[model samples]
Structures are given as C-alpha cells and as structure tokens.
Target: MPTFLKPIAPWLVILFPILTLPLKFFLKRIKKTREILALIVPVITTLFVSSYYSLIVNGEVLTNTVFKMNNILNIYFRVDAASFLFAIVSSTLWIFTIIYSFGYMKEYQNKDRYYSFLILALSVTMGVAFSGNLLTFYMFYELLTLITYPLVIHVQTEEAMDAGKQYLTYSLSGGALILLGIMFVAFLNEGVVLNFIPGGLISKSLLETGRSLEITLLVFLAGFSVKAAVMPLHRWLPAAMVAPTPISALFHAVAVVNSGVFGIIRIVYFVFGPEIVISLWTGKLFLVLILITIVLASIIAFFKDNLKRRLAYSTVSQLGYISLGAFLLNLEGLSGGILHLFNHALIKITLFFCSGVIYIVTHKKKISEMAGIGKKMPWTMGAFAIASLGMVGIPPSVGFNSKWYLMLGSFNQGSLLIMGLLILSAMLNAGYFLPIVVSAFFKEPITDFEEHQGFFEAPVSMLAPTVILAIATIGFGIWYHFPSLVVEVVVQNIF
Candidate 1:
C-alpha cells in the first residue's frame, strides 16, 4: 500500500520467484539448500502479493508499463481486484505445494531442474494474473505452456512424453486462436487501447452490425476454451496426470486450469463486458456448452478408476461451474463464479494432495485398489473425505457457498434450466466423489495390499498441508465472509 511500492509491487512479486531460479543452479549440489530456498521464495512472493490487499479492496488500480513496443505489443502489469485475488490464491497455495513436494519429490532425480521450472511457473503465473492487456496476457499464457511442459514429462517415460506432446498440441493451438482474436481486435479498431477496462474497451460503433463482434468473440472463446478444458478440448488434462502428484495438485488442479477460465473471464467482463456478451447472444451459446462440460465431465469422472484421472475429470467439471457463473452476467452469478475460483482451488488442491499422499503411501492409483486406505492413512483420507463432501456442495464446506450464489444467479437470470443443471451437477458431483470416501472408509482392504496397523499417514510436510486445507474447507465455508469480501469488490467493479 505504500506510495512508492505501487509501481514496483507487481514486478517484485514476480521477480522473487525468478530471482530464486539462479540460486537453484548455484546451490544445485546442496539439495537441502535448494529445497529450503524453494519453500522460502514462494512465501516471500505470497506476502508481497498480499501486501496489495488493501489497495485492491480500496478500489485502486495499479498499472506499470515495463516495456512498450509500438502500438501492438508491450510488457505491462496491472493489479486490480481480479488479478490480486488470483495472485494471492496461487502464490499462497504454491507454498503448501512446495512443502508437499519436499516429501513427494525427495527420492526423485533432477531435483534442481524440477524446482527451477516450478519456481519459474510461479513467476509466469503471476505474469498471467497481472497482465494488463490481451497481448501481455497472451505472452505469459504461452510462456506458461512452455514452462510446464518439462514438469509434465518429468518422469521421461513414453506415456509422459506422449502426454507432454498432447499438452503442447492443445495449448499451442489455443494460443494461436487467441493470437488471431487479438489481431482481429487490433484491426477492427486501429491503435485501440488494449488495456483491460472493467466495462470493456471495444467501441459501440464497431458492434453495430454484431457480425464482427460475434466472430472475434467466438475466436477468443474457442482459444481460451482449450485451456479451460471445455470438453473435446479437455483430453490433455487427464493425459498429463502422468506427472508427479504435486504437479497434478498445484498446476493441473489450480494454476493451469484457472488461467484458462481466467482468460475467458477477461474476455467476458474486461474485454467485451457483460452487456456486450448478453447483447451478442454468445453468452447463451457458451453457457450451454459449459453446462454440458459440467455434467459430462462429472459423469466421466464417476467411471475413472485412476484417482488422479478421476480428479482430472472432476477439475474439468468444476471449471465448468466457474465459467457457468461468469456467463450468467448477473451480480450473484459473477460473485459465485469469482468466489468459486478461489473456493474450488482450495477444495480441489486438497483432494489432489490427499491423492498424492495415498499414492506415496500405498502406490495405489486406482480407486478400487484403495479400499480401507482410510484405516492406514486416516489423516490423509480424512482430509480427502472433507474435500470430497465440499465438492458435492454439502454444507459447512466452501463449495456449498459458491454453488448457492450460482444457483441464485441462475434464478436472477430467469433460467430455470441453468438452475436445474446446477442442481443436477451437484448430484453428479456427489455421485462421483462420495463413493471414493465411502470405499476408503467402509470397504475392507484389498487382498494384494499388506495389512498395516493404524494411522500410518504420510510425512508431516505432506500431511500438514492436506489437513490444513481440509480444515480451511470447513473453516472458510463457515467464515465465508473473508473470501466474499474480495469477490464483492470484484463484482462491484465489473458490474
């Protein structure tokens, strides 16, 4: 909040992670130092991002132009309510994930390279959050794909390599569509200011015929939808589960998926504005598509035996909820959508973390193989159960609160079908997620697994974050006002 910090705050948040990348190489020989540095850098970065809380809540916009290239391209940063919320959530979660990674990656090779790209991904994610314009967001968005490819293929197996290739194919294709959309925007309005304006920067005169508007909007939506994992385009997600568990937890469940939907939010509220979206009738078309993703992904998740892939499919479904809320175009809907962005991140990451612990402790990837895992890893499965319930929108877990608002938003829009879909999606959520909790707790242990005593949980570094996030699932649900405060600010500005 300091006056001098305004210009430099955003860059500092990003640089803290990048600055550690070199030290990682310099200390490559010392594993302990590298690990500690990995934990400490993200802590510092999260704190720096949190420092802007008051600024954003007070409705102040922080903009810094790092570089300007003619009129079409530039490096810029803006910290508004939306960006601040994303920056803080991702940075804060990165800390726990790094801690979890210590236990998860202890025996793995190339510790230095993994940690380096891990840190670099945080920097790039921050760039995506704070990007001031479509061009800046696009640049960082593409960088994110490149930075994460190594992580996806860290195991270097044939499956991992194939998954990496699929990831690149989907991501680069999406990026190309996004670039085409940006070029169209530039062409339609020569020398147009591309900075994100809450009400939208596209001129009304250009939208008279609505044809150009519809085409550009479709291009942008289709481009961003690939990353958003909007079905047909979501295959890369399940395939990329070949990576390590921590990567699945933080990147796939939280950072990477959010970036895609976050881009769509920018396109809707910042680039086109809600009015334009509604006026063009594109909102209805995209809303139907998102609803399909919501239901279909949940149904698909129910059948997946692999825990990570199940969670991967669940992420696809949950992302649809976020998109559904945003397109609702009403205050309650946007509020629910934006709030779910944070709530789902917390809940889903916990689920993934629990899955990681189960994998590390039992080497069991399939749900059918995890019978009675709860007895052996009580703390881990306990956390997983809580998160699973939350995912189903049960009370006293944060997921219920966001879904509540989304339903309200649907009602406000007079679309009982959307409200019905929301209800049906919750049923599907319970259908898929609740059974895992039930099987882990009640079903007898499988014959192939050795019998264990009670409570053989994962290492404290891994177990602690899972438990903490689980507690947060209920805690934040009860104390919903905390996150709602920020979401309120975001909705107020956008509406």
Candidate 2:
C-alpha cells in the first residue's frame, strides 16, 4: 500500500461514505453527479478494505479509539477477520445496489433524500462491522435504525408511511431492551466494555446472579432479534417492502437484518461466550425460536405470490439459519453461521435485483403474473432461477455450501431435531422458490397474445448487476475453498 493510504485507519472505511452525505445537496443539482458520487463512496471503501486482507487474515488487529467520554462510554473501532468479512460483503454488494438504483430510481421522486439515507446507511453499517466494544456497537446500531427510516418511507404513500412507523416502533423498542441489558452489565462490571474473545466478558460474580444474568441475556437477544426478524418480532420487515427494491435488497438482504445476525454472533461469542450461553436454558429457548422462525417463515413464503414479499419471508427464515449456527455452541456451528453471513448476502441480493428488474421493465410484482417472464426476459429470469436454486440449497450454488456446514454443525451437536430442521427448512425453501423457476420456464404464458409479442430484457445497467451477482452465486459456491478459509480463520480466532 502507498504510505499516504497506510496512515488511514480501516475505520475511515465508514467515515469516507458518511462524508458524502453532506455533499448531497450540491450533488443533487446534477442528477448523474449525485448517483456517481453515491456509487464511488462504496467502491472506494471496497478497495480500502481489500487493502487490509493480509493484515486482518494474519490476526494482526487494527484498533482506533475515536473518543473517550469517561471510562465506560468511550468510542472504539477495530478490524479483525470476522469484521472484515462483513465489511467486504456489505461494501461489495452495495456497489451493485447503487448501480441498480440508478436504473430503478431514475423516475422516482426525492432522489436526493433517497441517495443520502442510502449512503448514510452504508456508513453506519460499516460502523456496526468495526465497533470495538458494546457501547460503540450499540451507538452505531441505533443510528442505523434512524438513517434507514427515510428509505423505508421513501415513497411517502400512506402504506409506506405506516410501514416506516412500524419499523421505528419495533426498532426503538428493541433498542430500549438492548440499553437495559447494557445497564445491567455495566452495573455488574462497573464498566460497559465487552470485547470479542473466545471466553465471554461476563464475570463469575455476575454469573452467580443466575436469574439476573439470564434476564440480561434474554433482554439483549430480544432486542437484536427484532432486526434479525426472528419469529413474532419480524412483522416490520415484510411491511417495509413498500420501500424501493434497492432499499429492500440492501436492508433486508445485506445490511439491516444482517446487523441483528451480527449482534447475536457477538453476544454468543464475545459478550456471553459459548461456555456461559450453552450452559443456560436460554440456549435451548433461542434454538427453539430460531427453529420456529425457519419453519414458519418458509411456510409463509410458499403462500405469497408477491415476489418481494416472498423473498422477505425467505430472508426471515434464512436469517434463522445464522442464529441457529451461533446458538449451537460449537465451532462447526459458529463457522457455518458466519459463512452464511457472506454467502446469503449474494444469494438474496440477486433474487431481489431480479424482482426489481421484473417490476421495472414489465410492471409485474406477483409471481402468478410472471408466467411468461422467463421467455420475455431470459437473462433476468435466468439469474433469478439460479439464485432461487441456491436458496433451495442445491449443489454448486453458494447456498448449498453454507447449508452443508450448518448440517454438519447440527449433527455435531447430536441433535436429531436440528438436523431434521435443516432438511425440513430446505424442503420448505424448495417448496416456495423452485416453483417460481418452474413457472417461468416449464409453464406456458397465461395469455396467448404475449407469446406473439416475443422477448424483452431490462436495461444493461439493471441487468448486469443481477447477472454478475448470479454468476457469483455459482462461482463462489464452486470455488468455495477461499471464502471458507476466510470464514474458518474468523471462527478459529474467536473459538
């Protein structure tokens, strides 16, 4: 790396994108300029993060403390293998989302406001990825909620407004619970610092408090689970599909929901540790909730004809797999969960991009209405089919690789129940996703005149990203060794 760039802390990966938000007004005066700036920030961040691969993977930790507001309330950021994995996934996929947004958002109103929040959300997401302590993580975590509200309600329609209100209600309530958990830990430890390590930060004295400790754990889990969209707390996500497609792809697939999944991993491996978390009935309770979420969300997806809505429910279920891997209390389990963190981002984003393409070019949103879409838009539907197969855990798809590790993790626990849950979930995934592919290809167009109209494809700008991500879905799966090594390196560091 160049000496000038060498001085830059990896945390600037977050700050760099944030600096763009203030420039929105000036950039907005020229539409193309604003969009290019939005795309450039994430692309630059991606390059910066790639520069750290050697340092992060070699276990050389990078730390920068931003502020010291007394002992318990300092702000800190650190980069490690695990955080870098998330940082790379978020930045890489976000570049494609920006590209997709250019084509998707061209005709939409309030492009300035939409781009600002999208950029800000990316900055805060990087914050969540690099946060060095609980206080810092919570700070960024809450800011993510505030910044994403505009994107959720970007349409400013009555339904969009309602969805935004529900999103805030759920997120704020979750934040309150997280704060309560932090207070309990701070009171017990005399400071609010909790760092990621194999053994958790909870002291023996605090553990002896028994019920109090359990309550704190449950409180923390409940708060973060809302974003993870686990079970009953997941209502806000499906409702928020009122937002534009790029926002849906970013928030539900990659950034927002993943924040919750990341939080649960931190709690399990960092704050509480597997030793303590596994010893409690809380582990079993969490496992049961994740299992319920996995099964139930897949079932819901089967019945929904609205494409984005189906994907929303699918995200809820797939997220359960991540949480399930964490709570399994073993290395194999943790590794599988973390691997899916990166893998699923690519898979889900491709699916959403395809859905957006379908809507933009054809004004079709319902799966039932897409009978001849495959013939009409072969490239778009082909990408959708490939991603759909991956979602079902088919071989040579990225989804299958993660599911393979998760199954091993489940069997390692000697829990037939979890093993069975994985199989059943895959079946449910196929139940919902495979039919879309089949309908697009094997089934005939519902209307005869459409066959005479011939084929059409989305704009190259819109089509290219989905195709690239779709290819990545297979390429990453086939060449799974490197990414698996990265994930294993991260899991090895923590466990």
- Displacement of residue 262 (Cα, Å) in model 2 is 0.2
| lDDT (Cα atoms) of all candidates against the true structure | 0.88, 0.87
User: Which lDDT tens digits does candidate 2 get at residues 287-397?
Assistant: 899999999999999899999999999999999999999988888888889888888999999999999998888788899988867877789889998998998889899
lDDT of 1 by residue, 360-433 (tens): 87788899898877877789889999999999999999999999999999999999998888899899988888
Off by over 4 Å in 1: 1-7, 28-31, 448-456
Scored against the true structure, residue 30 in model 2 reaches a CA lDDT of: 76
Q: Which ten residues in a row have the lowest lDDT in candidate 1?
A: 1-10
Cα miss at 104, model 1 (Å)? Answer: 0.9
Q: Where does candidate 2 have its weakest 10-residue lDDT segment?
A: 447-456
Best by lDDT: 1
